[model samples]
Target chain A: MEIKTLSQDGVTIVTPVGRVDTSTAKAFEDGVMASISACNKIAIRFDEIDYMSSAGLRVVLMAGKKLSAIKGELVLINMPEKIFSVFKTSGFDKIIKICQTFEESKQFFN
Target chain B: MATAANILVLDDDEDTADLFRQKFRHQIMDGIYKFSFVIHPEEALDLLQQQVFDIFISDINVAGTDGISFIAKLRKDYSFMRSIVISAYGDINTLRAVMRGGAHDFVIKPIDFKDFGDTLAKTVRVVEQLRQAEATSRKLSAISDELGVSAQLQRSILPSNSLKKGNIEIWADSIPAAEVGGDFYDFFWLNNAKLGIVMADVSGKNVSAAMFALIAKTLIKSFSQIYTSPARCFETVNRTLYNENATSMFVTAIYGIVDMEKNELTYTNAGHLPIAAIRHNEDPRFLECEAGMALGICEDIVFTDSVHTFSPGEMILLYTDGVPEATDKNGNEYDYERFSEVLRQNAIMSPNLLTRALMESIREFTKGMSQSDDITTLCLKYRLRVTPNVN
Candidate 1:
């Protein structure tokens, strides 16, 4: 899996490509968590990822927890319908901030 | 190991002895070939018993014993030594028989000494490589033994008794993927004889995972005693785990209090799957709610408990992701739909039978294929209501 983390306008965008199941969860978690340490206002793009397991959700949960403790902001952006269903079923969509596109997430980050 | 090799020969003629002494004069001066030529087979056998040689070259005809019989004796007596047969070009049948009897190689009569020397050297090198490989295999087997002992120790700490308490029967069991796992289930007595149910899956495998699970179980058990509410106990345990953790390890758990006196269950599903239940003439379904974030991530998040009131002949199931995530030989996952179907079929059974029936269904679906994660299931059934007027 290719995980690209870029900072633009003080917002770190983590875009992970390919499947993020048990085998790649550790690498994906480390990339996102490192970006959190560097910047608090972060957005993750879920469009590139085709599949994710509970292991992937575990990383997002930890990142959410850590960001919450520091009073920081996190947003899930450009989420596909399939990926959003997972978040919705887990009840994470209710507690976490999400947007339909990066443009929508910009205001939420501010 | 790279030193010159000693050479032994058996032949009847003294000319054969002089040919070797003259031919290897330079090698002898360099301490390479230490040649000993014996005319009689009995004398050569006696010389072999007295000392060792790297190569034993034998001719087809000799005094007292034929060269073929001598080679056979040399093979039986000194199997470590590599024997080379000196045969005439026409003696292909004899050469083939000797090769079959484990001669390292056979050289034609009037042999080219340099080619024979190279063959002997290669044979010795192959033997050394075999010895090294054997030593490494022995060392690895010793490490495997230690892994087995660690798995045994982990199983000993888990409670396996299928016990019943206060009109409730429970069965909680965990089977690891490759001998050990990070999944755990526990049921303990809390305030006012209330049964506290716990089901958790930590993110890891083997020994480190087992150690983390021990810490999680102990902290939850201790914290439950200190706090009366399940939500409070989970919050304190999560705070403790997050503070003590040095690695990125985390646990998704469900901690609940099953109050037999009140016919109620107060639970906090911390980033775990919604609890599965079969209640009062209804189908099997998950008790959906906003499960909080998992433990050992951040310390400040407070968990909230959701309460469920049940009737007699109703059962609650708690499990890790291992059951649905397990794949068959064809790599098809035994998903939630299959799990619910099994629960629906065995809805009215006792806690023990319900758990057994679900496990049997899973086994049938997977068809003995090895799973990648740990499978843990806990069933709590209220055989009779604590207070009969809650309808």
Candidate 2:
């Protein structure tokens, strides 16, 4: 998976591409967790992701709990509908704010 | 006593042969053992090739040949025969060289005839035991290979269908701790809009458990197609398995049916781990289900189904005890507290990553420790379309 970190408007955006399964989940967790520690507000852009297993969901959960511990903010932006349903059904959408576009996620920072 | 063995002795001193004959005269007279002596290394080699001697005794300092080299050559050609080396040089280097040359043991020359018979007896017993152990090890390796092949076949039974149905994304995985394991997970579409998911753990390991797992999995899938509720599906499957469970083995399972059109999940637990639900914006929490008897334990036990409506963007997670019960080198279990904490931490990730992340946490906690059970996780994300559709 490709994780590109973009720091714009005080938010670190982690965009990972490809399928995140058992083999690559650790790297994905490290990338997002590192971004979470460095910045107060982090946004994971899911534009390039097409498939994610429970392993990937685990990284998100860990990042969410960490951000919560630090009173930091984490937002998921531009998640595909298929991916969004995964977040919604698992109750992740409630804990981590998700938006359809960067504009919508920008509102969380405001 | 009947003659028990034949011993070949290779010594350069011609008088040594007569010394052995006198020393073991009682044993020879009793027909307990027979001894033969060769004055030259070449003569010993020629005799060894022609006759099968039960044991070989060689003197290290022969007139024209080194005992160590002769033993090494004997090992190269007749390795199955055990040998003992005797030398006047009692130094550690000579002892090590003899051993490296494949001598089963070493003896000092100017041979104490009194101790010689006792030493030879012990060596023969040890060699017999070694032969038995090697044979057992070969048989064990063959059984292990067969188990490996069966494990591969078990993995092949997992559903290969694309996990996506409408907006629901389902993913499941199982990892065995042994050559074969009792844990199994599967997901199948009951109909166009209904999905069936199963995660089960049998009570034991190896081929017996794997065979039962196959039977349980097949029965569950077949009964699920005919039964309407998760409780009824498990009830019928349980009766079928209980009648055939002569070994008294049992299986803990969690079976769920997802109504995709209505975004509802109906599930039942058979003495399995509690299911977890992660709601958007809220921390992940374990869902409580009615405590029912595990399958194959009783024929008349009743199971109850719990229903939970999927609020858009909610996830349902099911796993075997291998997750919470994973232990560290210190023997402390990973436990539900750590599992919940891990789930809360990785709550924002996708389904695949979520499961993968839990496995990573378990792996980290249990580093260097051997797992005793199979680890398995099944996750379903319910996402109905924005536009309404009929069920």
Predicted structure with the largest DockQ when compared to the true one: 1
Residues B264-357, candidate 2: write the lDDT tens digits: 8899987676789987778787887775767876678788999888887677888876787676887577877888887777666777877888
**Tens digit of per-residue lDDT, candidate 1, span B340-372:** 888888888887888888788888888967666
Q: Against the true structure, what is each candidate's TM-score?
A: 0.61, 0.48
Deviating ranges (above 4 Å) for candidate 1 = A1-14, A29-42, A48-50, A61-74, A80-96, A108-110, B1-149, B327-333, B366-370, B385-391
lDDT of model 2, residue A87: 56
lDDT by residue (A1-110, candidate 1, tens digit) is 88998788889999999877666888999999899999998899999996776668768877887898798889999999978866765446766888998889889777
Which candidate tops lDDT?
1
Count of clashes in candidate 2: 53
TM-score of chain B of each: 0.60, 0.61
Q: What CAPRI grade goes to candidate 2?
A: incorrect
Q: What is the lDDT of residue A92 in candidate 1?
A: 62
